[model samples]
Target: MSSLLRIVRFTRSLAPLYTAIIIASVLTSVAALAVPFLIGHATDTVAGALAGETPTGTAVRAVVLIAAAVLLAEIANTVISNVGGWFGDVMSNRMRTILSVRYYDKLLHLPQRWFDSEITGTIVARLNRSITEVTNFMKMMSNSFASMLITTLAVLTISAWYAWPLTVLLLIVFPVYVWLTSLTSVKWQKLEAQKNEQVDIASGRFAEVVGQIRVVKSFVRERGELEDFSRRFRSTDATTRAQSSHWHRMDVIRRAFLNLVFFAIYVIIFVRTVQGAFTLGEMVLLIQLMTMAKAPVESMSWVIDSAQRAIAGSRDYFRVMETPVDPRTAAMMAARPEGSRDGEADGAAGSAAALVRSVPGAPVVAFRGVDFAYEDGEDVLRGIDFELARGEKIALVSESGGGKSTIVNLLLGLYEPSAGSIEVAGHPSAEVPLDQLRSRIGVVFQDASLFSGTIAENIAYGRPEASEQEIVEAARRANADAFIRRFAGGYEQVIGERGLKLSGGQRQRIAVARAMLKDAPVLVLDEATSALDTKAEIQVQKGLDELMAGRTSLIIAHRLSTIAEVDRIITLRDGVIDEIGSPAQLAASGGIYAQLLDLQSSGDTRRLARYDITA
Candidate 1:
């Protein structure tokens, strides 16, 4: 009931249209009611003529007038009902639009951590199912409920005037039928929820499998995947069958009681007419009114079923909406600039770019005694301290799972530190608005992470309003222009999903061009060349060198040779800083960095495996 009320409240903005529909529905009910009365009057007039209790001419005229009145009433009912349906259709679609847009907007604002545990397909499935059921139920109610209520009330009142006993019996059946239906609601909803879970899991896995089809094919797991998907759906099928059986068994019992009560009603009306308590026409009118009342009572099961589904759907929808958004992410969204790029403020002077220029001598990035952990997990980094001055370049050298990427994630505000603080551009990182902080930094990941779009679109993603010439210039500096222009569509070529249509080198270079277009003061190359062949790495590294020029750069690399040009190298062991020095100094210091360099230099594959380091 609360969910139903919430849905009602959510659509309060469309009240005027709803009010119009209700008014039309009432008028339609009134017109329909007139038909039975007119037909009954005509029957009496004909009977009077046959009994010779009135002139035949008088009876004929009265019958003709009654017939015309019935025709007019039927026409009015049809027209008014259609108008109400039109209003309902408009309101329902508007409700759907409002719901879908808000859901999508909420998704955009949810934090990364909230998304980490969710499946992409499950989230999409929930949105689709919830919105579809809610809107469809609303449309059904808007079109039918008003008319049903008015018809039921008019029938009951008229029947009571004719015979109070019959009215009492009809009223008794309603509560009994409703009580029986309510008995199944809890159990039915439980099964429905179970079914929904299985379906969501199946859908999530289906999307995952399709998205990583190459991996599945290489693994030869197609049969296993199909069996798993079928198993989930079969579970849903079993739950659905049980739910359906329970509901129908209850329905059959309810209908039997209804049949007995209706039988009693008909018998009473007939006996009363025979005893001269009602005229032939009055009997007909009473019987028709009973039928009208019975229609709504019989439909109660369908109404309740739809309502339950809608309630369940609405509950799911609200669950997502009610989840707490990260306070920092909320602030970031609230502070987003209108009609400007994502991290830019209102104008050039107040933008993050300007902030970078204002703090020329301060450390561009700093981490002081920072501690970090995943949710409910041991710390990945502890008491880490680091700083990068403007135009300085540093590289993080560490074995796999040694917290290099985690540091980059924390620096970008994807996650907060468990303790201590980080500072950017002379201000505590927590004090800096996310948009302003992120606008000052650019990052290139090893995977490239390009979407399915034209090459130009991907390049200009950071700054969508960048001109063609600016995009081309960024591409040229990233060493991607020559190969891009050779393609049939040049920069306009469509890159398949994640840029799979391009070679590894081409994709990496395009990612480099994208970062170049962002033109941030601080650059982060997170193993940008680690996934490429030697030739590809050489080509991509040239672009990386160009991107890092005159910028405060933080590079993470597994291969020790890549850091030879960096001003300093910070090495990690067991989630804490183990060494910090220039490459030559670290080499001579015989620390973790020096040991890894020696292992690589000696080509000792066995020794490298212990550190999870790969060449």
Candidate 2:
């Protein structure tokens, strides 16, 4: 219920439009109600004429006037109802836009850890289902609720005026029917929630399977995937059957009570009219009013069903919206100047510069006693410490699961260390605004991670404001300009998803160009060229070398030969720094780096396997 109220409050911004819809609905209801009174008057006129107590000419005129009035009322009702519906459509779409934008914005501010535990498909599915249900429910209520309430109230009032006893009988139907429906509310909602979970899981898996169709086909798991999908939906189907049976059984009881109440009212009305206790026209008017009142009662089940769905949907929506955003990121976002492009806040830059000036000769990047562990897990990195001077290049070499990537992730503020602290550009990483901090560093991952867009768009992604000449220059430096120009569209050519249309080298070069365009003071290469063949690696490495010039570079390399040119090598063993020294110094030091080099030179696959390194 609270969730439903919160959804209603979201409409406060469009109150004027919503108010107009309600006003139009009320007017349409009034017009529709006029028909019953006009019909009753015409019936009395005809009755008087039949009794020969009134002139036929007068009766004919009265009937004609009443019939004309009824026609005009109906026309007005139709026009007003249509206008109100238009407003409802506009408001509902606007509501959807509002909700979608806010949801996306919240997602942006959420921490990476929040996303780490969630599936891409499930996240997207929740947004679609929740928003659709909420908007549809709002639109339906806007179009019909006001009119229903008005008609119900008008019918009851007019009935009471004609005969108090019949109105009392009709009133009894509402509470009794509502009470019966209430009996199923808790259990019905429980079943509905269970069903929604199964449906969400099925929908989430469907999206995942489609997105990874290539993998599924390669593994020949089509039958298995289909069976799993079918099994999930079968769970939903069983739950739905239970939910329906419960609702209809209760509905039967409610409907039976309503029929009995109406039966008594009808019998009394007919008997009184035959006994001359009521006029013929009064009896007709009373019966029509009673029917009008019954219409809302009959549709109550549908209204409640829709309302419950909306409530459940809204509960899911608010669950995400209400999750606390990462406070550090939130503060950074709030501090950013409005209308500024990403990471271009002049004030933030000035503050960062001031901190640098105050701490002269600070390391470009540093880690001090850093320790980290994932949620409820043992430390992946422990008592780690290192520093990168300005314009220095350092390589990190380690076996698998040695926390090499975790170090980079912490530097990027993706995760906070469980113990100790890190500093970047002379300021504590936590103290620096995220945009400003990230703006100073550029990263190219093992995967190119390119989106489907023009080659120019991918190159200019980090700096969207880069000029055409600048983009071309960056691409040339990355050795991507040649292949890009080979395409008929040149730089304007669109790359397929994740740059699948291009070779490994081509995609990596585009990523390099993007990093080049960013031109930050610091760069990170996370095994950027390891996926390519010898010739491709050589071609991509040239661009990487150019990008690394005159900047602080942190390299994570699995191949021993690739780090020969690095000024220093840091080797990790079991989450602690095993050796740190110049590449030549470590080669002769007979440490992990030296041992790995020996193993590589000897081509001893078994020994290399012990170190978790591939030759």
Error of 1 at 18 (Å): 2.8
Measured on C-alpha atoms, candidate 1 has an lDDT of: 0.86
lDDT of 2 by residue, 105-155 (tens): 667767778888877788888899898988998899989989989998888
Query: Tens digit of lDDT per residue, candidate 1, span 27-63?
Result: 9889988888998888888888999997999998899
Give candidate 2 regions above 4 Å deviation: 331-359, 605-615
Give the Cα-based TM-score of candidate 1 against the true structure: 0.91
Alpha-carbon shift of residue 118 in model 1 (angstroms): 1.5
Q: For model 1, which pairs clash?
A: none
Name the weakest run of 10 consecutive residues (lDDT summed) in model 2: 339-348
Candidate 1 residue spans exceeding 4 A from truth: 53-68, 332-361, 605-615
